[model samples]
Target: MSEVASEVIREMKREFKVVGKSVPRRDGIGHVTGKTVYVDDISFPGMLHLKMVRSPIHHGIIRNVDFSEAEKVPGFVRVLTHRDVPKNIYTILCLIGVGPDEEPVLAVDRVLYKGEPIAAIVAETEEAAMEAVSRVKLDLEELPAVFDVEEALKPDAPILKPWGTNYFIYEGHHCRRVRFGDVEKGFAQADYIIEEVYNTSPIEHAPTETTACVAKPEPDGRYTVYTNTQALFFTMDNTALILQVPFSKLHFVGGTVGGGFGGKVDVITEPIATLAAMKTGRPVKFKYTREEEMRVSSTRSAWRMYFKDGVMKDGRIIARKVISYADSGAYNRHTPYAVTKHAANIAGPYTIPNVYIDAYCVYTNRQPASAMRGFGVTPASFAVECQMDKIAETIGMDPWEIRFINAYRNGDMRPHQKVVEDATLIEVMKAAAELVGHKLPEHLLKMHSWDREKA
Candidate 1:
């Protein structure tokens, strides 16, 4: 361990018993011994399996749906369509007062993306449910679809949202906007202008265990839900609102999730399964098959970022302008919030006098994108670091020297108007150089995060 870190740990150990001590994990034994209980491990008597009939095309108007053959299946219990849902339209962030409730519990009239659920089939067995779902027929009229973020924003782009725009509306603005100083003046005064575009594809979580839930109707006039959801109260509350039932009537049980990585936070599979149990007075299990988990479940949104930086010959950045677009796919699951975060972070950690950023949460004919590990910030960091490297190369300066010169200090102000209080970029970089066996120049070695005047 580094001397500084070791000293800090020793100081903390004097005040706290657990600090600097090895601790045993409470759940490690259960996990290693295979005794840990997961949502799919629990089953009840008279349980029914639920499967969905999804849209085959990316964008289409539903012409007709025929379930006659599906009803003939031997163990077919019943089917739930949009009509069966108590409240059809929902936005996952509605609890936080975010939205126009753009997503449907079950798609009606049209399907915006492939794998969008149109109907759900319940049967005595999983195989029977799968068969019934396959037997159901759908007549859809295909429509033009847009996948590219830039293409979706063009004037000639096919409209996707009901609000007649391909992007999420942020407070009367088309995109989240951040401005601090005069970027044009700074750019004109700079010696060189560096511009680059960075693009990232959508990424799937693909947890070891797929999303699953079991809702059972209790004899005491309440419902019990066994779920793998990362958010228990959030899911229960949203499920209650979707089912139009009192919150007191639902009990959500969640623990031992195989893996989430921000994937299982969305409130899917619980409400519909609970409703099925309510209608039939029996337990209903809704589990996403591997195919459904991979193809239909929410993934990290794809991002396209355009970065333009103005720098002097001495390795100091004077201005930065970033235009970022996040492809939120068909619905507003969690991408709106993610875009807001992206807008705040795309400026990066460096302190520039003039900064301007516009980040848009765009919609396209693809599977809806939601959260992943560092959903919004990770992409921005990737683009920002790459842009930093490009700037260093163009200015004929060492990358570390450039970073050390522009690194934000403790009292620096960010583009978002927040004062940086505890920044340690210089110190951390120095420690990293030491650990990696790289010798920084004397001037760079003397730089500290507390005071930038030394640099």
Candidate 2:
């Protein structure tokens, strides 16, 4: 539990049903016996299977999409392309005021990545749908693709997004920015400065159950969907917006998920399956194949971070600056918000007087990335903690001493001017250092979290 949660529990003092007590899993027996019904386990009498015709090239211009051969295949029902969708553009995070709807349900004029879905093929059987999708022809004009975040931000790099720039607009700014005190003055006053760079590649969620959804059109003119999505309201609202229908027209059934880890929150499968069901007036089932799940699904973003620190000889962090780039892949899935969150934590938990931060969410010609556990702040935390150790090594000071000296206190101010209160960094560090039997100087060991004067 977090420090604030523990504090809140102590204040409540009346809770005894579940707090701080061991509880049995409610669905353990059903899960162990394989009696729980998943989306794939449910079937309908007139259900049609859906398969996607994914792009084979990374970046391209669509000269033509020829489905003549696909139409001739036996049991072929129909196709859902960009033209069929009510609204071809949307952002998964738009409902939370994060976007201008930057993603397309189906590829319109061109595709941005190798696995971009260009069309959906529906048929009486899943095998027939797959065969039809494989037979669909694509006439594409390949364009040079940019893979690196730094290169994508360069002036000469090819523009991948329709925004005519590789980065998202954070209130008309080039990047999400943080400005506090003067970093130049901080550097001038410091006894020494430390600098380091860190990089991380994209990470896939790879849940045990791949993304799947089944949509059934009801007699009341509403669509009922069964999915494993972690967020139900997102599925309902996004699916309705993509279909250009009212919110009352969609119903979601979920909450029993195999595993999410922040990935299943994506509203990818429900919107298209709902459209297919409405088009055919029959139930539609769409389940991502293992290959599709791995290749086309959103993953954790690749991050490149640059850290600079100014410190005193007495183990005090005086100033800090961070410049981070979030590789958002072909679309701004959730990187814009992630970048903002990353920028907010540029100063970490230390009480630094001067700080400057510029965090960019850059686009690349790869599969669009999205949320995971700690979606935005994890990478920043990794860099911050690692740099603390490096700073100790350079200044010949114990890391615990350095942390104790600058840990946030009640009166300390964040880069955004929010006052820190009840910060436990000092207490946690001392306890952790003791756990490893790492000794520190007596003066530093005397520090406490509640000691605002020492902080």
Candidate 3:
């Protein structure tokens, strides 16, 4: 190996000491034996339970909200509307560093999606609070709704967030272009060109523990919240910002998380519980039903991709282009970063000379998409890999061989013009192919069959 390669390997092995070591999990026994205290186990003296009232229409103007009947409920404490929430808009995935126009603590004047929170109620009991939430009267003037990104981009479509256009956030002014060689010359030298469109559906996080949080106000004028959150720091930041309180005055504790899978990264039930506690000056607990959890929370974005590739007679790749539209439903959340990552990774693990991509993060009337396991790379890979197989078939080559020949190597520039240094992608691909016995099949046949006659 070269000196540089040797040094890189040494450093990698040095960093691998703790990479795959099997240590006893911190919460193994507590988690399996149900001895751990989760957010749902929290209860405080003189505490109230909270419930939110959401919009039933996909898009509408809020005409009126009446809390008189809710106040008459058996043990109702208070009914909160947008008027009660502070006038501040927040981005749920502000860590990606986008503007504040993406999301808000509560729906201010209009309801863009079917289950957006419009009002909330607190009572001595969860059932009573839910009853009061159901009793609250809301008058909405329904507006025409657009559920698709293409429809939302139309000139005549209704604006989901009137202050902001349907476009959530552009990646950067000119972040979508990547080129290595003369694309016109490369395509002129190509023997064949192929194009395909692919679609991927949105999926849920479906964490074992649904949304739940408990907020307790201390006698010293400080608040502590227990929640099922992935990052305690981000949740603390969101709570402090939303409540207009100092970070020092807020204390956030994450319990043994049942499962996150990138879903528990947002301020959902915690903010609602905090609002109830702050308003009532007492501890408050809020938990979401499975249906409510599905309706109000974010999920993975649906993708529609158009991919094109130019290949030589010997299966060398020349050029590529990808155009994608992502559904950033109801809120911007992580759509900006997600779309940018998709744009950057559109070429997959290939050494394409010319690459161009345009991705739209358009708003629609559904749940806003947040981070998932792959965090926007999976959809791009799905399209590109399928296209790679198609290109291989056209040029009489195996998919694995084509990918191996075009895979990134040391000093190779990626689709976004980033230089690869001492990469192990080729080695990993070789190991994977060896382990999986890579081959193309000529016919579909059952690989395993049960033999009842032997018994």
Give the top-scoring candidate (lDDT): 1
TM-score of each: 0.97, 0.95, 0.89
Candidate 3 lDDT, tens digit per residue, 17-65? 6664576888888878888888887788898998888899998888888
Clashes (N, CA, C under 3 Å) per candidate: 0, 0, 0
Q: What Cα-based lDDT does every candidate model obtain?
A: 0.93, 0.89, 0.77
Model 2 agreement with the true structure over 217-236: per-residue lDDT tens digits: 99999999999898999888
Alpha carbon lDDT of residue 70, candidate 2? 99
RMSD of each: 1.5, 2.9, 8.0
Tell me the spans in candidate 2 whose CA falls farther than 4 Å from its real position.
1-15, 434-445
In angstroms, how far off is 16's CA in candidate 2?
A: 2.0
Supply the global lDDT for candidate 3: 0.77
What TM value does model 3 have? 0.89
